[model samples]
Target: MTATDVLFIDDDAAIRQAIQQTLQLEELTTETFDNAASALKILRPDFQGVVLCDFHMPGINGLDLLKAVQQIDESIPVIILTGQGDIGTAVTAMQLGAYDFIEKPFNQDELIELLKHALEKRHLALENRVLKAQLRIFARPGPRLLGGESPKMKRVLSMLENLVDTSADILLSGETGAGKDAIARYIHETSERSQHNFVAINCGAVPENLIESELFGHEAGAFTGAEKKRIGKFEHANKGTIFLDELESMPLALQVRLLRVLEERKVERLGSNVSIGLDVRIIAATKSDLKSKSERGEFREDLYYRLNVIQIDIPPLRERREDIHLLFHHFALIAAARYGRESIPLNKQQIGLLLQHDWPGNVRELRNRAERYVLMGPVALDEIQSAASVDTPTPQSLSDMVDAFERSMIQNALQMCQGSIKDTMEYLGLARKTLYDKMKKHGLDKAQFKEDADHDGL
Candidate 1:
């Protein structure tokens, strides 16, 4: 929607043509629609323009259209076009939520003036909506998502906003430091489930044998270390949400039981036949490509499909470079407050370095740098130069950082592929020769990545 956008609806062709020409002369984009139904298709909650419709049209009249538009977004300005006999109806439309009414045989200048005012109002409404959303996202008492205006981040924020009030199982995919944890927390804290518990578990950190006990708590004397009855994370998160981090690391054997819980919405303690009813929203985060892993038989395909009902991909910091300054300032403010230090602003050269650096660790790395800068001084910015992967950074850090990032990516791919060079190449989109060359360059052995699941009790 643009500044000059106008949705003009009138059954009269002559009147529609006249209005379109008038608005065009006034430099307005009039999208003429004879039927209200057609115009309704284009109308969205975030429409940034005014609407004009004739009162006594065919199927849906101006009053009915006004009601529908209000339902979509009450802030939209709907101007009704009425005749002399329709004055009473026009007043009724106003009471029903119309912005203003225009009489037939009206002066063109007055009509243009009213539309200008309405367009300004529409623009202000949209601006205020964005401002309010930002305030809600960043003004929370606890740690919040470092809000930004970058296009990719804005889409992510918009999707998060829509999900806060809904109880949909969400799967978040991102790199290790890409703020998936923060996003999960943000959703739980801002939603209606805020009063309930938000249980989080790192699937990869727990040992193989005890992982089941940790998740599906046990009864007294159920296992070697079981003493008293205990509740599982799912039980504790009843009527709330449970975040399963590092989901790809979940063992294949446990995945069958996990799938049962998700499908049944129930959880049973170990050594107990009685099933406890559960009502928990599941939010799983995975850094690895679960589909690829499942295809390679490293993860359960059924369970992967079950948890992937709705997925949100968190963009890495390097992809949203436009937001560097905003994120830096946001973290710096929090760091300064915590460290009891002044929030010294970065100079042009320092800011340039911050922008130039390819942030491999995403928000976590930036937050760490901000904290260091607050605790120390300008020398903290120098750490970024030493840690940066780009050429503008120090020569010592540049090659080392790039090589380290590349090595880690290859190692992770190999690990996920279970030492299959073909699968690794497919996953990394690298040629066979190139993959072998890099493996040799990084001194990586395929045998090191292959794990014996049975021996490891996974």
Candidate 2:
């Protein structure tokens, strides 16, 4: 669990010192403030902690500080610490939204127990807020792809939008977990056929013997265990979309049938002479090169041509490294909601580790890690560090080395400036246009850098 810091504010230096020692013994992370004004400076709406303020102070006493803290984030638990026989003041503090009041010369065990409860309340409140925000994101028009202003993603989205209303079959090419299925769903959602069913089947996962029946239904008594007529994916997706994931894994015999269906806009059920016309659009995705497979007789060249009418290639996560922070936070927020925890922001070192590591599993791997981090914070950090330390071949070409250095420098500058393009350009001593050109070339986005810094206080 991620620890929440406690802000202890008291006017008396001796009181602050004593409480600090007590809190340390309790193994609670805390910050001491001599005055309420100083304490309020560090208070923020997103602060993950509780505030403990002295009831009577020279300036801006506990009651007033409570109000200020409420204005920032009413959910934050602010406990009032008062002197002995201050029951009236403590009661008044509770009415004004103070979590609980503890009288000085307070029992150490009771105070610790109260602090633990307050911290738990604060943690729950933060998790609720995160969940609500995630719901708002989901309640938007369509499924989100979680892309920032990176040029590569923007272009891909643009292409998808352009093909949304078209009936042409789409072939999505990218590494595994690059969100080809998501892109397919997005196309279906934004298209005119969204009201109809959108069927999906993993070509590689289905048994070769049953793949044909799965794609184009089996009639009654078609084969053994074919007791009744059933609708296939293609028929079920009539006037909608059918996504064939891992298209390269489809059997060669099935490829011929798929091509015929694409050409004739119809399908024949197993053991049935009648052909059913289809108004469904097809979206095929593959991690392998279908053209190369076709050349090697592993896949049909005619079928490849049929599906490749409108190809959409999704860039892997490594190619669009600048969006890593943004994507990580997006998935982290989701994980936070799923696991009922607050999303831990990645520090500069963590972000650097993410950028340095080669994501062989792509966006899916990043998302899984984000969930793990939400569930087990520092443990995920150790895993990332370990991954970063793995040995990889160094760039042998001078141009490749220069490019690597340039990308790293740009990332460093962006990190330093918190993703402000103007500040980053100034820090890097480059013209705005030059910085933009380089950023575009390297698939870097300044906004994402700033977001990363803001997320974890980098």
Candidate 3:
């Protein structure tokens, strides 16, 4: 859906034209209409704008339209333009959730400022909505998915969710620190076989001379160093998952045996006649293109195809810039708790540094930076900017800084109070309705904080 700064609705054609001209002069994008019906027809729950409606419209009066807008999205700011005689109705509209109201013959500057604030609020609501959705996906036990809002990460989220139950083998393609190992573990943890063993091995890290024996457990006396019979990873992970990192680095000779094990769903111990039946799901990760390597004879083409049943490609941090802030924020929070420090949300300058530097190490690098920031504070960000050859970070508006700071404070208070609204209100010295309004404005759900408290053994 297209986004506008304002959805202007007034039954008076002259007033609509005048108000539209005034808003456009301030460079605000607006869509003006003569009646509430036409305006409501175009309104959407995801509309990234505010509604400015006249309280005395012919059909669907301002209060009724406020109700309709609330039905669509209560988070959307709705401003009422009321006549002096309609002050009582304006108050009623406020009671019904109008963002604010302006009396007739309002000062143009005041109106512009009001609209600007509303627009800023709308932007935050949309962004917070997205963050909340992603937060839920990573809220489960063990490693969180820590996915992004970018298109590529959204696709990854969909694939992971869809494959949580299926028994198909998975191949993860991504650069180092792009979280291939974490993704592999997430798949296994979320799958039906979570109760079984999850064996992870780095194909390249194992010495080639003993790699074969390491994979297909050797019987005693099978090798010069083999003193006792051993079970290999495949057997060890029976009815569970085996994640092989650096799959392309596995020796060609071993690839042949790996292919056989994958095909027959069985493994043979070295120098043993018994063939153990298997039920293992292989999740292989590679930093390079396995298909290209297979064609070049560096990797076995057959084994590549077998593991390629489903390949999830994780985009680098630079590629999904929109997700950088959220990822950094989450990591920072976790770091603060670990370090027993008061979590300090990133200011405009620090956020600029984070966005400006292209993360060569991807999520791992960002996570490290978060931990460092928690331990060292803003100086770490300055150090990062000095060491990296990146553009100066363009700062956010005052509104953004205020909203982020306010939200951070409210969230921390809620956590401290274990989501008790009364305690939080008292701690913040806010009236009950005022605190609730702020919470709703920032998309802070008390129940989530309560869950967090319970999980943390508070």
**Predictions in order: lDDT:** 0.79, 0.79, 0.79
Give RMSD (Å) of candidate 1 vs. truth: 16.4
User: Clashing pairs in model 2?
Assistant: 418-450
Best by TM-score: 2
Instruction: Identify the superior model by lDDT, candidate 2 or candidate 3.
Output: 3
Arranged by TM-score with the best first, the candidates are 2, 3, 1
Please give, for residues 334-377, the per-residue lDDT of candidate 3 as tens digits.
66655577668665566666766767798888888888888988
Better structure of 2 and 3 per TM-score: 2
Candidate 1 — worst ten consecutive residues by lDDT sum? 449-458
Candidate 2 lDDT tens digits, 1-458: 32335899887898788888888776566798888898889788877778988888878988889899999999999998887767897898899889999877789899888987887677667756765865675565333455544457778887877899988889999998888877887788789999998889999999999999999998999999999998899999999999999999998888888889988999999999999989999999999998899899899998888778788888887666656766776678777776689886676567667766677788878888888889988688687677567757332455654565577668667755545566677777899899999999988776455333223100
Clashing pairs in 3: none
Clashing residue pairs in all predictions, respectively, total 0, 1, 0
